[model samples]
Target chain A: MTETNKTWVLRSRPVGDIKDGDLELVESPLAPLADGEVRARTIYLSLDPTNRIWMSDVDAYLPPVGLGDTMRGGGIGVITESRFDGLQPGDVVNTGLAHWALYNTLPGASLAKLPTLPGVPLTAFTGPLGATGMTAYFGLMDIAKPKAGETVVVSAAAGAVGSMVGQIAKIQGCRVVGIAGSDAKCKWLVETAGLDAAINYKTEDVGAALDKHCPDGIDINFENVGGEIMDAVIARLNDFSRMPLCGLISTYNATDPVPGPYNFANLLMRRTLVKGFIVIDYFPRFPEGIQQMAMWLMEGKLKFETDIVQGFENAPASLSRLFEGKNLGKLVVQVSDEPK
Target chain B: MTETNKTWVLRSRPVGDIKDGDLELVESPLAPLADGEVRARTIYLSLDPTNRIWMSDVDAYLPPVGLGDTMRGGGIGVITESRFDGLQPGDVVNTGLAHWALYNTLPGASLAKLPTLPGVPLTAFTGPLGATGMTAYFGLMDIAKPKAGETVVVSAAAGAVGSMVGQIAKIQGCRVVGIAGSDAKCKWLVETAGLDAAINYKTEDVGAALDKHCPDGIDINFENVGGEIMDAVIARLNDFSRMPLCGLISTYNATDPVPGPYNFANLLMRRTLVKGFIVIDYFPRFPEGIQQMAMWLMEGKLKFETDIVQGFENAPASLSRLFEGKNLGKLVVQVSDEPK
Candidate 1:
């Protein structure tokens, strides 16, 4: 193995919009592992909206990433060297902190063994069947609590979590509406995902479109894109509506604060409930989400989609595709050939 | 008594703001009572923020007040004439859909006798010990659920529900911060209401001031005023903070849509929960709130103040004072007074 590995680090804090120059790829010799530490080679990398949040210095649910530090992300890897008990070489594991690198050494406690899912792709462990799937399953069934005969609307419908949320709502006997950026995504959501209705937000006025389709108004709104689309959803909420806020992909790369349509008074007047949550908060129920999602997939009740970009060198550009709404589904970067 | 009475009716919908001309005081003769109807006189009218919501044509939690109809409100009154078995003359009771008039007829089912609270002021049954106190008590305890040693903040701190909310947080062993409009109100909050800190929002920079006082960030925010103050509070929320949204007094009277500061990303980044509630939703627990509040009043653990404006003729002007931030406490209008 080569002594030096390439990793991406934050070069400077982004002022308004993030650019590729803001991140730098550097080569450095892998540090020798201390006791209870292991060296692992990256196999697959996950890109999410939260990475954009880590770039800002403002106080949030988590601390801001320091300048010159490795960009934080989740990855699937195989252990190449281990000094820890129980962990052995060639063991595949899932870890939360990973850089855009080929090889890295981290503490043993930071990694969890990747549980085997028979006949499912190993890369599914990094996508819809992993954190993203668990987020949608728990966030909809637990927080939103959509009842039978209720109208459930999800934004970014063709994306990873949104796709799962629409399926889960349907399984719970709800009339589901999906909002996506393109007509093709809308058609895929309706034809493949079995959504009750799909609105192409790019071509139609979302608020008026929702009014025509959901005359009864939305009972539960799974919010993923929190900008103008959220403003549209707010106008169509029924009394006692619940909104499970998952992500804000629309505003992740925003240089300046995007001015919202601002209808907070509507929330109060409609007696609505809006809550923000991360999938990690529901760690206690991860196994349950996985079990249900797996059963659904096995029974052909759930379908999975991935927008894979080949090659480790394409990782940076692939990640930025999510912010531009270019990805059709769960976005992933193939780091290297699957381990034999 | 006369068979007919004078009542104030909504003559026209206000274009941007309400004025005296929009309402007309008119007299109409009452028809003979049918089988289930009873005649009653207006005694104590309940003025609330919900009245403003009812006036707007937009879809709200409740139906809008229709044109040329008697304005909707709740009132405690005495039966003047009865055609039903359960009600009789001089029975003091609470009823909704009561017209703002000297006297009118309603169904016997619409009225409920005001429960006797011995040694407690009857006016208390109408103010803090009534809907306002119940809203504050349940909203804080049930929704916000602040833990001991955490900080809880309330807006409109000198007003009815806000005053009770701060004291209740303190009783639960949490530090409390109050935001009011005047220096005198701030003094009253600290010296009289026993809040840990009070900020006169009109004189202080609320965002910067809150940062100095609540360094750990707000854990529970009982929102009553919802404009700039809400934006300021939203910016300082800690992870998993809860906001029990009760009212938006700031935007209640706006003729044009007021652009907000757009801080919803703060909700997502902080993993905060914001829930809007109407007091009627907590009706099943009303007895519990009333019993505890009554005991607290007797034990001197809770104190209440009211700004009673004399004469039903001044009701409209007095109600307007709430939106203007002129009312110091629970604003009520006195109709006819009897010798004590």
Candidate 2:
């Protein structure tokens, strides 16, 4: 039997913003499964800011996606044929760099069997039940470690990982404040995500707002957007404040190098801990994270929003959604149908 | 009995470099020791880069030294007269804010009695065995936590704190690389302090030098001089790198606000940690740190150089020695004579 596969292939590295023709969806024949390998049908493609980083030829967490190669992505896929003993044809797998494709053929050991999380859709496996959720979990609990009554501030608080960060910080008894671009996003953070305060970074003077909101100064900063917003939050950092340096989305598209925060000396004066972490570091405990996040989701204490664009052809353009502040929560693409 | 006290008073805030009269050596009549007070004669007055920070009306580890107030310092002093039960005549006391003065009247409880070492000089109390030593100990050991075979880079490696940071990192079994302004300081770091490598930041391209010295990337960065030096070291950081931000002497005398390191994003890219710390935070453990450092010193494994600028009259002018790279190691002003 033969099948036609549709995949988004990198045409060229992006200069600033990813444009059309940068990633071209090409048609190809699916390869027959070999020993220790499996053929999988892609279900969901995770569009993230890191996707842009991978699209560029700059130094990043992973090597830049090679020209003419499939666009790197995180996604959920269902195996159709397997020769490896570790995976069966009926298995649904969650994996990294699964590519923006309708089907894939790879070693079976590379993919993890998707955890059974009831009430959580397959879309969540690309988001809250995947690396996105785990990023929020460890970046908050492990790095920031917010305590009760402490003022916890999260930037990009309306984004997928950030929204979870605010909710989880609230669960930890922290006075959560979020920094987002839109007034509507601010409203959702306060009303829906349980954040005590939301600073619309676009309209509000963040420094003054932080002073009024975090009167005791910020004990923890969950940074996603790095720019003046980070500088404003850092200026109000209390002694021994923790900043889990995750993403600097503001600079991902910049043509030149991004300058360090002007008030960076606060890192010393306040004795702050600024640590960068990647979700991949917590892969060993992904099962534990997924389980905890599942319970929170089932309990209604944790809420996530998935802003998904259908069709693999739209995958490349959708990644710009994160940098543009266009996506409401988790930004992803659904490429193919999954079995019920 | 009555005595005349001489003090360096803050005449004006410095702009770029401190001038001759930025601090006025004013003579004041010493007040008689009241109940619970002592008349202490200053011995060795520490002239440090922080003096410039304190001189300016900017935010620092301590409040800015106000105009007309006696200049704040750290020093070793001897009690000439006492009315308090806690102190008596001829008792040597070490304290912070020792003031660039010949005499001071205060409650004796604020001062710590200097610990005696058979070979250690009175200058060691204000230098190696004091706050400067403690800064190096905690910033390197507690913040960086360098392991065996790790590459440790220390900027301002010839200064009081930076010198010790490199030496202690050596004791911790790490490859020590020193960054200093002059060839002499570089030579001393390698020849006297037993550093693995030395980079004369003035003569060599720091980034290239770092590449050659730390071939495997830097594990711990004991940062003292900020700006280009910091940016250079940060670019060479390994994954999970730790930087103990101690001081930013290069920016101390700047007329304008100092810019942040241009490559600060390495904190995220390399998953590095940049933690700012002050030694006072570890005051409860000072005795423990001093004990360990003292043992290291006694073993001949640790060596210290004292830059003593004699005469209390030159104390204010001598402070610029730190910023000018005139001092070899621990810079201090000998205010009064020690008993024979």
Candidate 3:
């Protein structure tokens, strides 16, 4: 084990788009684990759009990350040293605020043990089978409440939560439409994820495409991208439609506040409902969501695609891929060479 | 009784502001009552902004009024002649689609008998104690769900539904802020309706006044005026705030679609909920709502104000009063003399 660690810190606020200069790579001496802490080495780091929301000082479901702080992230790690009785050395666990660091000390309460699977990749614990999967599960079933035969539209349908939302809506017998940035992602959504239809939003006119694909109009919209796509979806919502707002990835890197088309009167005309939700609020139902998701995965009824980058040094670039729409699925940075 | 009766018909759709020329007073031969129908004299006409929503060809809670047809309205009338076993002569009853006419024949199902309240004004049956009271009752309790100590803000505070909402919110132990068009209306809301605070939105900045009145922010917003006032309220919503949407009087007479600020993203940040409600949806609870409101009125816990315009021919001007914000409380046009 190395006595020194490499960590990435948010050097300054991004102006328009985050660049390499916005992040600083620093080498620091590893600190000893306290009595209730476990020293862990990063294996896989989760890259999500919520990181952008956390970067700003705007009030949100969670508090914003302060400048100069180690960029907050979730990761799967292997315990290298443990002063906590519940965890032992070599135990793979999950923790948040896990910077792009090789070694870090985490409180015992902040870590959850990851169980090994025979065929599933270790990164699955950080992707579809983890927070993203749970977010989709609860946001769809609990919030959107998509009924059988109803049309469910998911924005960013090839990405983490969006991918799961499309597949889960399909499982619930809903007609699902997936919207993604690339044609390849659209094809994958239709072919592998079992979505009824897919729209390459980058290439197609979203409102016109939605009109062609969903003539009955959207009954449940799992909103991930929140600027123009949201405006289009809002215009086409069926009466009594439900929108489970999970993320607004489209406006994450925006230097200026995104202005809406502001057709809120449509909500009244269509009698539609839009609710914002966070996965943490549904924590009590996590076991039920995880079990159902696991069963679906085991039965081969659910599929997850992940974009895995090779090393910890690639974390910054890998995270940027999310905002650029370059990632096709759950984006993860492999921090170490650890076997499943 | 006159063999012929006068009825007001829609001459043409209003180009800008609704004028007297848009409606024509026409004489029609009186038709005899048929089975299950009663020939009635229009005694009182209820003038409301919702009538404008019904005038347009657009789809809404109720079907739009066909052009060249008699203007549709709700009114209390004496059944001068009756073939229906449920109704008797001289009986005052409530009915819909009752034109701004002196006489008309209506189905029994479309009418409810007005209970006798000796010495109480007959116009009260056509005002706050009528559909307006029912709207306020259901919109607030069933939809907004204001809790004790929570701040409830209502627009058009001196108007029909608004006045009831403020009094009811006070009854529920909520701190109430009423927004009205004039200084006198604001004074009425505070001194008579027992509102915690009242803002003359015509004279004061609504958003800033709301800040002064409700420092913690509004928990329940009873939306009647849906333009800039709605925009202002949206900006000050606390987390999990509920908006019970009833009417948008602000846009009723708008010849062109009124452009709204549309601050929908605020809903996500505040976790706010805005729901449009039609009182008919709460029909099962109508008896309860009516019984409670009636008791409150009798006990002087609920005070009602009526702006009555005498004479049936004056109905057009009376209806126009709602759009101009000229009437206080419920606006009603007295069509005939009340029985001694």
Candidate 4:
């Protein structure tokens, strides 16, 4: 283990898009774990659009990550030291709001012991079978519950959570169409994720493309990108449809208030449901969700891709890939090697 | 029987406010009833905010009303002539989409025989126990499902659907607060409808009043007025809050597109639900809904007020009451006298 930890400190609140100097990487001496505490060495630090929210002073589900504090994030790590009976060295744990660093130490109660499955890589725990996977699972199954023969539209179809949501809807016997930025991502959604159709939103007219693909009308909308794409999908919603709002990456760094869907009146006109959710709200049911997700993974019914950036030094730049649509599947930084 | 039937025809789509010239009252020769059809004499024409939507070319759940067609509406009246086995003269039936007329003839399949309740006035069917009431019934009980001890906030609180929503939420043991446009409406919401608190939006600071009344956070929001009032309630929503979007009367006459709640992102953050519906969707369960509404009315557990505008000539002006926040309860236009 290194004598010092590399931690990203919030130097300033982002004005628009997160820039290089918004968060500064600072080296600090590693602190010894106290009683009732455990130390986690980050193996895979997950990067998400929500990272931008915690950095802002905006009102949100959670309190803003204090200025000069280590940037709030989630990761899968192995415990290197434990003073609590529930944790031991080499135990892999999943964290909700850990610091963006190589080493994070807190009371043992703050960590969750993730159940493992055979042949499933630890990185999978950070991507598909961990919080990201659980978010897709609960948001789709519990909230949207798209039935067989229904048409489902998912934006950000190439990302970690959106990819899982598309596969799960397909398993439920739905005709799925995904909206992604690039033609390559659209191709992966149709060919790899087994979606019925994929619309390259950047090139194709989303509303017309949606009309062509979704003749039966949209029964469910798993929205990640939230501006015009959201409005177009909302306009095509069937009566009594459901929209599981997982994220709004489109406006994450806007300096001013982003105007909402002008056609939100459709929610009233069509009797459609639009619900926003965070996975931590389902923490008590995480085990049940993980079990279902693992079964799907083991059965080869669910497929995934990850953009794993190497080295701790590249973590900051890797996060920008999410906003730029530069990364595919799960975005993560591999800070260090897992324990032998 | 009268030789001529007075009916309003949509002459042209209104640019902003619905004008007298928009709907021309036309006199048509009373046609004989055809096979499997019945003729109904309009007693009470139920005026609603959706009347404006059907008039516009905007994409909606139902198709736009064609120009020169009888203006679409709902009404309660006695069957004057019947060619169907299920209906007879003097039998009162409810029609979902009758025109603003003195007499209407439609296939019996289009009419629903509303159950008779002792001590219940026919106007109650147009007000609290009819389409407007059913909208409040299903929207609150089935969609929002505000639990006992939760706080419910309603916009347009003194209007037809909003009035019923407040009472129903109260019956479910929820603490209710209402936002209305006038001090008189606010008084009626508190003194008559039994709301815990009422905010006069025109005079009171709604956001501050809501904070003071709903210190525990709002759990369910029955939004009838959209735009700013909708945005204010959204900011104060509790985690897992539900919003039954019954209408957006505030923007019904806007010539340009109305912007939605800026804090709509709260739907994602708090996992809140926003759903819109029309009463006809619950037709299969109308008997069940009417039965409950009747029982509540008879027991005096539910109270209602109808802003009844007499004379067919006053029908067009009555609708404008909704946008102007002039009606106290259900806004109804009585075309003819009710049977003794």
Top candidate (lDDT): 4
Instruction: Supply the TM-score for candidate 4.
Output: 0.95
Candidate 3 colliding pairs: none
The sequence of per-residue lDDT tens digits that candidate 1 reaches over residues B1-340 is 6776877787777665578877777789988889878887766677777777778787777787799987777666778788988898877776555667767688997666666676666667666677888899999999998799999999999888899999989988998999999998898889988999999998899998899889898999999988789889988888899999899888777778765546778887777898989898887788899889888888787777777788877776667777777776677676655213
Identify the runs in model 4 with alpha carbons over 4 angstroms from their true place: A1-3, A109-118, B108-118
- What would the per-residue lDDT of candidate 4 be over residues A128-227, giving only the tens digit for each residue? 7878899999999999987899999999988999999999999999999999999999989999899999999889999999999999999999999899
Off by over 4 Å in 2: none
Candidate 3 residue-wise lDDT, A28-91, digit = tens? 8887777899988888888888777776676776776677877778778899888888898889
Number of the top candidate by TM-score?
Answer: 2
| Residues B151-237 of candidate 3: C-alpha lDDT, one tens digit per residue | 999998888889999999999999999998888888889888899999988789988999999999889889999888988998888
Candidate 1, DockQ score (0 to 1): 0.66
DockQ of each: 0.66, 0.78, 0.42, 0.78
* TM-scores of the candidates in the order shown: 0.96, 0.97, 0.92, 0.95
lDDT of 4 by residue, B277-319 (tens): 7778898997888889888999998889999998888888778
- Report the CAPRI category for model 2: medium
lDDT of every predicted structure (CA atoms): 0.82, 0.86, 0.81, 0.88
Q: Candidates' interface RMSDs, in order?
A: 1.8, 1.1, 2.9, 1.1
lDDT of candidate 1 over A1-340, digit per residue (tens) = 5577778788787775567777777888877789999877888877777777887786756777889987777778888889888678888887666666777688888777776776778877776567889889988988999899999999988888898999989999999999998988999889999999999998999988899879898999999998778888988888889999899888777777665447777777778888989888988788788888887876788877888788776776677777777887788777766789
Residue A180 alpha-carbon offset, candidate 3, angstroms:
2.8
Instruction: Provide the lowest-lDDT 10-residue window in model 2 chain A.
Output: A112-121
